[model samples]
Target: MGDGATTTEAGPESAGVGAGLTRAHWWILLAAALGWMFDAMDQRLFILARSPAIRDLAAGADPSALPALAGWATALFIAGWATGGLVFGLIGDRYGRVRTMALTILMYSVFTGLSGLARSWPEFAAYRFLCGMGIGGEYAAGVALVAEAMPARFRPIALGMVQAASSIGAMLGSALSLLVGPQSRVGGWEGWRILFFFGVIPSVLLVLLRFRVPEPDRWLRARDEARRDPKPGRELGDVRAIFADPVLRRRSLIGMTLGMVGQIGLWSIGLYTPELVRDVVFREHRRELAVEADSLDDLARAWATETGGDADSKLSEWKAEADRHVGRGTLLQDVGSLLGAPFCTWIAIRFGRRKAFATAYAMSMASVWLVFGGMSRGVDALWMLPLLGFCTCGIFGVIVVYLPELYPTRLRTTGMGFCYNMARYLTAAAPVLLGRLAAGAGGYSRAAIIMSFIYVLGLAVVPFAHETRGEPLPD
Candidate 1:
């Protein structure tokens, strides 16, 4: 512990009042939740829109090269995420968390909308990368702010709620795709473009946040103490402070390792739900078409001749069905995520921190395997997608609740940001690996199953994580 080493143990007086969160706590939680929610929406929007954007941009290029281009674009976004997280994390420590958070929200919101104006693949990628940087910075600042501000007893719920709200943001993206996507064409703009434009909505929240939300008292106190110190490296929010001592360094590494497991499992495997849905639905459409065409050849020929149309009408119908299938799958996944986020809080509170993580890891592995391995039909996917979403994304709840508790106010954001974002360097390559593995005989399922093993690594590391339940935020 550094400057603010308040004992985590509950005193008799404090223990008696296990009532409810205060107004300030609710406000902090709401602000953090809204920011994180929009961040998630933008991320899912990019994932859903990437293919269409790439296809249009690569219009004259070889079709086979489009997948490679998508991979590169995804990698670029991850690069931006990693870079922004590291850089803004330091800024958060040096500056006030609320100020840094507002700036990050503005940064991501503007760039995300600008991504809509991209004319070519490179331009689109450039804008997305910039947007990713903004997205990356928001989490550290928001989580750190909420962790330090909320009442210690309510901290877990507040943090978990913030992470849970992201599922709604993701759902908003999916809903937009269904409503304004290329198929629907709201306002005559492409669905992807319209979705990107919606990114501007979050900037509105930024105004309210900056005007109303207060900086954590802990951060203010730490800054004041650092200002009074005359020694070298007495500066507030020093990123290096996390590694200056053995205990801090060990905690930092453990947090980072845990984050790495979640990132690889998520970015590589879970995020690919759209692609898998598309493939399964399209393949099913083709098979059904073949069977129908074979069974009703004479009747279909007569009907076609009478209607003055060819077999293309059936193809159009199949396309529509495939789209519907994918839309439904996405909706279910979001629903699962909604439920899972809250469930994480319950589990962590009922059990301890380590056990909660262990259970989540186990569930993640099992759900992912079942979704990708045994399922084939769109209907089957509709049921399985939510379970996958629940397990994969729900675990992030632990991050906001656990990481900040491990460090003191001085190094809190720095250590938390470092741990959360450092894994991006390795996980950035996940999309490329997924493409390669999908190209194999086993396809996306095999690749996803292989990737799910990343969760097992998380389970292995759970024992080493320091238990933080009922503990106060380290000064």
Candidate 2:
């Protein structure tokens, strides 16, 4: 295991603890959370943009093959995420957290704009992969910075708020798509491309970060402490030290298991909500929807204007209505995510981490299966998607809070990145796995049902987890 927290790092001398996170610290939280929020917005942009982007890029591909192609893109994006997290985690621990956050945000923001310009599936996926790298790295840096900077008593709450703020980014993407996302490639303007272009806006964050946020004092002291008492085997950011030490190894494995449970359940089932709505829930209503064209929304009509002046066509109207249904469904699911993340944090605060996790896992299983197996139309999705989202994605709060508490100051970012990003390595294949399952077992709903059982694995793993509720983040 790693050694104790350096006195200079975790010692009461750490400022801002006096005022329950004083004004300066609130700025710290704001900067870190906004960085994470923009990152979440980029991620949501990709999820919402994936199918449409694939459709536009693969101009002549068979309609039946599009989903499979999109799965490949998701897989590559996730693989890049895992790789970037592992590398940048080490960089943060050894060099500094602030530097890592800056580099990652810039990397993703630039690549996100590039994603809007890709002409083929491989090109688009490559841009997304690079963007994923920046995003994956940001999580470890942001969470560790927040965990180390806040006083022990309020750290969990602060971290929970950061996670909750991500839901706002997601909601932004959902709402933006409904208002502005185009349904078809009209006069060379693709709806998905327009969205990716907007993602570049987050690049402006570096300006705020430049003058405001600082590296956590905890990270600084640990680096200095190691310099003064250089231990040969326990160097800062030592990836080998993480596993070579027994207690840290145990913690690493358990953390990876917990991460995998959520990542797979989310990437495999929960993240696919839009496709599920488009392919299953909204599939049977084409004729019914056609009859209601007179009842069509002005927002939907405005949304169709991206058709390069062909807004009055029956085809454009139908596409606009279809996309709107998917948008509302997505927005509801994200709303649940906004609330659910904080609910899990609150549970951990009151009952303890283990109980909160167990409850979330059990509910995730029930809600995902119920929604997947029973829901058949947009009406069913209104209530069901929110519940599914609440149960499935909320444990992200527990993860952001719990993992940082499991390691010492020296190994904190490296360990959190590994345990969290490592699961992503395994989860990288989930999109492909779901595609194959969907192909063989009828469709996405059935495939999602098979995947939902992974949450049951969370139930089994919960007993082995160490509860760190109310504890100071391990030094």
* lDDT, each prediction: 0.77, 0.81
lDDT of 1 by residue, 102-171 (tens): 8889999999999888888889989888888888888888888887876666667778888888999998
Segments of candidate 2 deviating more than 4 angstroms? 1-19, 185-187, 286-313
* TM-score of every prediction relative to native: 0.90, 0.90
User: CA RMSD for every model?
Assistant: 4.5, 5.7
**Clashes per candidate (backbone, < 3 Å):** 1, 2
What candidate 1 gets wrong by more than 4 Å, as runs, is: 1-21, 182-188, 290-317
Worst 10 residues of 1 by lDDT: 4-13
